[model samples]
Target: MVFFPLTHQIPIPNKDIISWIFDDPKYYQDEPMYIDAQTPSHSISLSQARILVKKLIAGFHSAGLQKGDCVCIHSFNDIHYPILVLGIIAAGGVFTGTNPSYTPFELTHHIQTADVRFVVTQPEMVGSVLEVAGTCKIGKERIWVFDVLGEEVPDGLRSWRSLLGVGERGWEGFDDEVMAGDVVAARLFSSGTTGFPKAVDISHRNLVAQHVLTQEINKKPWKQIRLFCLPMFHVAAVPIIHTSVLKAGAPAVIMLRFDLAQYLEATDRFAITEWYMVPPMVIAIVMSPLAKNYSLRSVRNVSIGAAPLSRESQRALKGLLDERAIVTHTLKTTIQRASVASYQIPKQNHKLIDDNGNEITTYDTPGERKPPSLFTTTPNQAPVYIRGPTVIKSYYKNAHATSQTLTPTSSLATGDIVYCSSTSQEWYHIDRKKELIKVRGFQVAPPEIESVLLSHPGILDAAVIGVKIRGEECPRAYVVRRPGRQWEALGEKEVRRWCEVRLARLGRF
Candidate 1:
């Protein structure tokens, strides 16, 4: 009982990501493509972006970057982030990104798992990155400081600009279908069912397919000005900011970090027509007093994803927008597109199965949803799997992890539980089959936090779980005190303070 897309399949372009972007005439305009929200003057037009990307491609090649080599960017969102991503792929290197807030321990895991050969980081993050680089055996020569806003590089450190060659080197575009489908463009880390971050290999074909399918389904006649407040490292932001926005000829306002006041001001200042956000940001807008201070009348379309937004919250958020504005809820996984409207996407199909590995054809019945595959699985609140062109074929350098998640026919085990409504023929999300916790929009694995907590001498045993806190999912921890009287003095406040310094903001319990 495989459910196919309601829409017809569209032809996906067979070209490298860079070639697909540059070859499109729609993206050839001189208008601003990426604008720094804080410093409006610092913006890059399409032509300027192309030249910078070309320079980066040449730079990467000069720096001994070879095909399939991985280069990591550990920095806050910037106007030039997209440029760096494109440059890496254009040069036949795999681009990976890390959370800017990651501590040395977390950064070490990312660097080692991705096999990062080169690192581009902000001056402020250079210390931690360097520390992690040393732990990962990456040399100082391969690490560069990226002053995204200012031209002055920190003393005694090479700037990312130094990688740029004097002239652009010609990029050999991929015309072969097999090459385009197999070439890995990016390696984004995701905590799958294993509750440990594993590198997911996103091929050039996945990028192109997603870009095409998204554009085909969403046909907007008006020019779109998009606000990018979501972290660039997340899977949700990568395809949209780097590929879709560029191909759609939209102007994106880049925010270094999510400051509510600044976000509202930018929306008003830029007259942002379309943007993507998570549920917590939506909740903030609806509940915050500052939301009324700025003008959000210009925003007409808002897409919320990463976590589920309640119907009540969705309705409340719409009141803050223009009268004609519509709020769309999407559910996107790291490996595949799991939107409620995914049935409209071309070449996509989904199905539902019960615990006995039987397909559930009856609508309104909750079952573990999976993409139709030759493999059988008996499993969540009932796990939803999806098969599509955008789904990754494997996990980078992790054949065991890949084997556990992907079926022989390439259907991805999404680890999401959902049910389809009989009347509307739409999917509804219930819960996750995986142990990963969704805080705001970020994925926080319990094992990662539990490991940190176990390191404390005061605690004998620790367990972490997700709990609904004020309309958002937050991590809650339970611990057992050690037998020693010295451990009795360890208070919750002290433990929390210790964890704050060691863990990322989202991972802190």
Candidate 2:
């Protein structure tokens, strides 16, 4: 049985991403749109951002950036990062971002795989980027420093500001629906189930659909002040920071990186109404004592992604916030499809199959999630799959990987296990199919045991992994004890007993 979104379908515009975002100038007032969390004074209003984007588009054209060319940003998040992203798309260039902490070897792989034509990086990382670019046969002329604060450029390199053209030769909008669907807007690298990274091609239509669907699902009457702590390079951050915030006409406070103290301070300082975070950060906010000092009362909504959060952690997170605050979980895939509030987006269908390759008709039964298609012979607990306007069409320059993942019906496998509820029509993520462990003919999920371990007051953090013992697979747990004199009395036997009572026989480590 295939499940569809409970929500009604909403029409998406066929215009390019830039035109869709900057649809009406009157929508934005004189208020700033993007603000720096560290230095609140450093901000960009929507009007100012549009002017900068137009100038950058002309500059990109001057620098020989043609339609379908790829431009890579290899740096941390800045206040003006959104401008650069919009500029690239407005210039008919695909925008791709690199992990700021990547090594030279990884950087070279991204540049080659994504077919990056130009690179924009920080002044501090210019030397390493140039070295990696040289190995890929990219010259210094194609490299520019992304100095947003008017900082001095490197000795042999030019600042991104220098690329701004004087006149207004901005992007001529794409009104044709066919061209919007065919044009690639961004090439994001995602290491799905397979450890190797592949460049996922996201088109203009996908961006517009994502924006429209997200807005349709989450309709807020109050003003939203979002705090972004996740890295902008991740696919999850692209739609939120780059598109959704702009579409809502909301102000977003940007953080270059996650720091517990700084994050807490920002929450209090900005009265942040919305948040986009990962499981680790949620755990930190709940387990760290520093959270007690700051005020999280201002946070009205929190969305957790990247990984699943334990029910215990979710409860603790809610306790720290206002009584009316809503904490929602988001399921994200590298293909760029997502589900908010456990409700699937309109025009998307999800299928669940059991271990014997039979479709699971009853809700509340565990099954390996797959995209709806005619083909039925899939590996047990195969990757989760999705087919929709928001999903990517294919992986860039890698036909073999694309063929292995995308089904004949054009659905992309996502490599995750999930179960649906009959009453609420909500989907719950179980675990990564590849990460499930078999113990005495029973399959066990590590997250289940980890969640139980985390509930113990004595434990601060925990991780569970499978280990082979006496030719039988067994689960092993590594737990970090909370630091204190009282917690020191807690021993291994105590932790084991806690799990013995809370977990099933196969789940106990």
Could you say which candidate leads in TM-score? Answer: 2
lDDT of every model, 2 decimals: 0.78, 0.81
* Pairs that collide, model 2: 383-415, 384-414, 384-415, 384-416
How would you encode candidate 1's per-residue C-alpha lDDT over 1-509 as one tens digit per residue? 66644555578888888888877656557888899998888898878877888898788888889999999999889988898998898888999999988988899989898988999999889889877777898888888888866756666678888877557886779877888879999999775446778888899999988878877566876568999989898888888898776777889999987888999999999999997899778867876889899899889889898764556667878988888997887777777843534344667777665446566666553443532110121121245556778888888888988887787877777766566655566665544556667787665666556657767777766788989988999999998887787888888998899789878787776
- Cα displacement (Å) at residue 264, model 1: 0.9
Pairs in clash, predicted candidate 1: 368-382, 369-383, 369-385, 384-416
Q: Which window of ten consecutive residues has the lowest lDDT sum in model 1?
A: 371-380
Residue-level lDDT of model 2, residues 300-369, one tens digit each, is 9998987767888899999999999989866677775566226667777777656555766566524434
User: Residue 17 error for model 1, in Å?
Assistant: 0.8
